[model samples]
Target chain A: MIRRPGDAQFTAFVQDAWRPLYRSAYLLLGEHGAAEDLAQAALTKTYAAWGRVREPDAAYGYARTVLLNEARSLFRRTSWRRELPSDDLPEQTHEPDPSDRPAVLDALRLLPPRQRAVIVLRFYEDLDVERTADTLGCSPGTVKSQTSAALSKLRRLLGDAVLPEGALHD
Target chain B: MTERLSALLHDEALDVPVPAAPAEAIIAGGRRTRVRRRLGAGAVSAAAAAAVAAVCLMPSDGSGLRLAPDPAAASPLDPAGWAVSAGSTLYLGNGATAQLPDKVKSIYYTSAGTVVRTGTVAYTDAPDSAYALVGDDGRVHSLGLALGDRAPSTDPRLPYLAYAQRRGNTGHDAWDVVLRDVRSGDVAVSVPVDGSFTWGGWNAPPVALDGDHVYVGLDDATLDVDWRTGAVSTASHLPAARFPESTSGRVALENRSGQPVRVAEVSTGASVAELSPGGGPGEGPAAVSISPDGRFALLVPWRTCDDDNACVYDQPASEVLQLDGGRSATVDLGDQVGWTPDGRLIRVTGQGVDLCSPVTAVCDPTGIRLGEGPVKVGGNSYES
Candidate 1:
């Protein structure tokens, strides 16, 4: 486990976590420019309030919380739309697996802010309900309900698509 | 199918790109913020120092630096030789892009008959269009169109406006909104609504038109209509007991019942999960506006200090509440009301006219003026 991060410690911490943090922001924001901006903003805010943080090991979690809040704030400040290229690209050029369905992301984008956050933390981050609730600053019951509601909506929107067998358990 | 969907979501999640230069950008932003804070501190210190010097330099006879008072600083209400409204008068500048001056207020043609302005400008941009009302002079104007293209047709009533028409004869003809070329009498674009299935009654006029969408207020339903396709979607709706007053897709609805108003996005229809301004009942919502970009929702809450009700009618204390996603901030406008075209600053009226730039929530009483009529501070007066 990492020790508590001070101002000096933050520089190293940021350097280490920057990549994954950026990836998480990109997924939440959809636009590369905004994702970059959001990630940097979260990190900067974390640095500014570092002295107030009680636990050094929890800095990463605190930064993630800031990122989530910022992502939600950005969504509110603008009508965010992910630019989906309409052209059919060759399989080799596609970043994700060619067989991966894009409709799921589309449906996910349609969900409201809170539900979207819950899903991102629960599924993508592989966090348990209590942990997800802790990160979101909400009760575990709220997290459970939001996750259930979001999954139900996703199911309705995606129709025949279902979660992979071990995906939820993870 | 659920498994497939989850897999796809996971794949997309993994493919999201990381930003390359985050630290540099944050550092730059921090530098700028630090500079601004220092500048503000300097200004405050300078003012304090000046006040002390004034006291120290005063002669026993009481005459100190009494040369001719600078005329520029004497009259606080003097106009700064610039147009003083919430929006800008020019298109290329940093403020709200100016709308064409000669055109009528807020009249427009779409699938839903002619849309008229209610005289309020929203703070956020609509998801689809730039909605405005035709002015009282009966001239039709749009925000981004060139003056030559905006000339009203000879028919007057049936101006050659641009609109999106419905294809074939779908029973959902009600959803067919269009953008008309008022001068040429030609249909510019016809958008087809593919799968939208719900329709809320019209509450207000369509305010702005973007390339494919028309921003309209259907009775209590605030929505965006695809001008090319007749796709209809709800953006926000009016709270109960609140009838809409002047509106740009963002509206000012009055809660006559003195109850706190709650609005929700139509997609989550009739669910508490989607409701906003979830305050206790009885706290009425004052006139409110949304930014043109649909990013921020501004709520003005009014406090009537008198039981006569007449006192509360015109001089209620007004507070502006800006809601951005889960975060919210309260801005004190004193008297200013309307927002600029870009939604960056609000035009406020009070002791002297001023602009409250929301990015900072600071009021600059530099170059603003109050016009005639019951001067609504944040309301839009551009529409006919």
Candidate 2:
């Protein structure tokens, strides 16, 4: 294949953005194969829009936004296999261990796609309400409501161990 | 609480083995996109560049239209013969499918042909969107236009595609609502709308195209823009509406309280018909789509998923409301996106296409397989 002038720089960007993008995709989509596909699709799209990306340093942010958008689209597709939420919540009467990965991931899979995205963006990505809303293409009020709803649901499911009292106050 | 949740999330994300970055594949995809963009470098490319430049150098006089040949008279096909795009293929009413150069994001019907928006993926909001006009003969003509986030609006009776483009920075109160003739690939009209408009969730102002008028959604009010003469006025009839969905000269209005209470005439604030009030709190029905003649409205009731299991059923008992007599029929709206010009409800799914009637609430299966993937009907809001 013939190489373009910006191929090397874009290759470097893909290498740098791959891991974080994959992790974020994994958090949004609980499956490994789907997460890998989402991350790669996002990076490929970022490359397509590379000409518009004025600042090279901002490439990662652009890729992240693209990944979130792709995740949103995937959630909307009817063909996508949705993880059905069970009526039962795992009993958690004690302070939950932070390293308890299954409980958190399962709880996440239980939340609606939007609420899950809000949790991932707010807690994992550490984005504020406004930035999260901007990235998710929603209103701040929507972000806040979804965040509150998600936290309340998570608290009920995981109990005070993982999300303690006054957690919803945040 | 934030810290604990954050820690738990980090712990969950940690140790997930990431595969090697496919840099070569990504670069190759990007290269293919660039080449596809330059498909017709002579006329179409020049026209696209001119349109971009005209937008960049928006005239202060509110007259940015670059003159081109008069568009051919609109000759829309039978409303029964509609088209839909699944993946990269466009399934026409005649049972012939045309493969698009890229993944079809959304399709819009014009008298000229089915206007197709193709992108890297089927996401309506994806970047680097390219527009093409697909004829009945299955010939594809690239419009060479890449409208970033602005949704394209079209009236089946008209040959132009309209959208609102904000001028300058966020603080700027000025916007140029452009109408591009799909046939000639020229800016037929561009008028400036001055206001500190807030376009709620949309990257740019949302617009709805009627015969000669374009209703532009702004923060405080909807502007009635006469594209032919560049006359701008407030469509007080619509009030402060966003995502103004319209066809057959009627605009569907959503209640500020989140319910769709009525459908109104665009010209006059006259009530076309009063929509049935949705269910009680949290169960309100959403006005999803309107029939082409504005005589029928599709209302899908909101379903509450279990808080613990967040599982939403695939299909809901959607209803089609006759605006004339208040008669309603139950139909599945999960896959129904738009209406045929003759007023039949168009439902597209991975299985096939189904055309339903609003009056009888009965769907006639087309048995036309769209193959596999997401399907976007031509008259949907994503393509307007």
Candidate 3:
């Protein structure tokens, strides 16, 4: 073992980061099972690098970076790409058609994995462009371009009627 | 549309269920990755081992085979130097050599021993090809071909051959995984595998079996079949769809998504070296092969126009590194690099076929120089 972070501290980190991290993973990969694996893997990396992290408080951020790296690496693999969930929504019991999942979800699915990751980090996680770029290991300009491309593609797929000028903002 | 998209994603993400975090499993797995990596590097007595790092490399006796600064040779396929096998015949230079083992198609090298894959006509088209384990001591054991259209995977750590044999093609094609104990000539375990008969495509199930677990990769999921208990379970951390290669079930090469390949050696449990593709372009390795001793790595850097968007992987350079923190140096050379049963590396450079120190990357050029510009390395070159 390279770095031995205390068990209590590691457990505490997992307990706190589990939900949010897993949620981020799910948003990144769009699959529950994969999201869990990604979160677990990210946490594992965080634990391994715990001793190397200069700032103890920044461990969560370090873990998130690892998670993003794993997700991006996974994007390069065809087999992992196959693990993408269908644009299908959860089954509704007493509701309308399950096929009624929004066209935008399908558009998000159609977007490249990194672009989708950018969208999830930007909108879902509500992280700033800089933070998103940092997470993705890309320049802010690249992040903006990715965001512009992703939003343009999403808008094309969903149409202007569904998106107002400032509706995507916080 | 952006607002709607965000709202839909927000709603759908909430709908995505997060399974209970297996805290123990996560912790255990993390430790496993760490432990496996440590194990791969071999146990370090810390302060003491660091002291012994020096004086590790001395001039060698060449272990019955040594190449000098530059050895001369004529043909790359010249069998006069080392034994080469063609079909059922072995060659000693251009002349007919001793007959190869029965049903022998080609010979390959593993960290443990020489692996001879056998079948008749055009190299074993009889459903699957079997292997003959020729021990370093020169004892030969022939393991009959399995049922499927693929050969068995030998466990580098043990003398076991794991293969999936055909059982039925009716309904869903059924296959059974067989683990043969090569020395005893005994079937260690024969367990039936789930899923239809595979036609052997990209999505075909991977048959990586050993004494412990038989990894059965199906389209929907990948499974670990316990050969001993016959218990099948979902492989954790491992993508159920892709069956990664494991050296000891502890450390494995996860044929990951991106180009920088990953080796899942338990560094602490879940932490293995996830090689990041850094450096400008071809400077990063396009392909990486780890030595069985876990001491060295053969890194084939991404080459030529491969860095550009058009990408041509015509790079013919492979480097040997002492990745395990030993006194090994990075030996760089032309393409076609492999390992001998013993840990020596074999490289077919334009100069000649050379034996290299895995750690020092220094090549002791064998006299077997290649005159044929650049010829493909045959399976026989695996032996030193």
The list of candidate 2 runs beyond 4 A from truth reads A1-170, B1-77, B122-125, B167-171, B201-203, B281-284, B303-316, B332-337
Give the Cα-based TM-score of candidate 3 against the true structure: 0.44
Superior candidate under lDDT, 1 versus 2: 2
TM-score, candidate 2, is 0.57
Residue lDDT tens for model 1, B303-353: 222112111211223333344434444455454355543354454444255
Score every model by TM-score.
0.36, 0.57, 0.44
Give the best candidate by DockQ: 2
Report how far off residue A142 is in candidate 3 (Å). Answer: 41
Number of the top lDDT candidate: 2
Error of 2 at B204 (Å): 3.1
Clash counts for all predictions = 84, 3, 32
Q: Per-prediction DockQ, in order?
A: 0.11, 0.18, 0.13
RMSD each, Å: 22.2, 19.5, 18.3
Interface RMS deviation of candidate 3: 12.6
* Candidate 3 per-residue lDDT over residues B13-73, each given as its tens digit: 6666667766666676667655643442212111100010011112222232212222111
Q: Residue B209: error of model 1 in Å?
A: 8.8
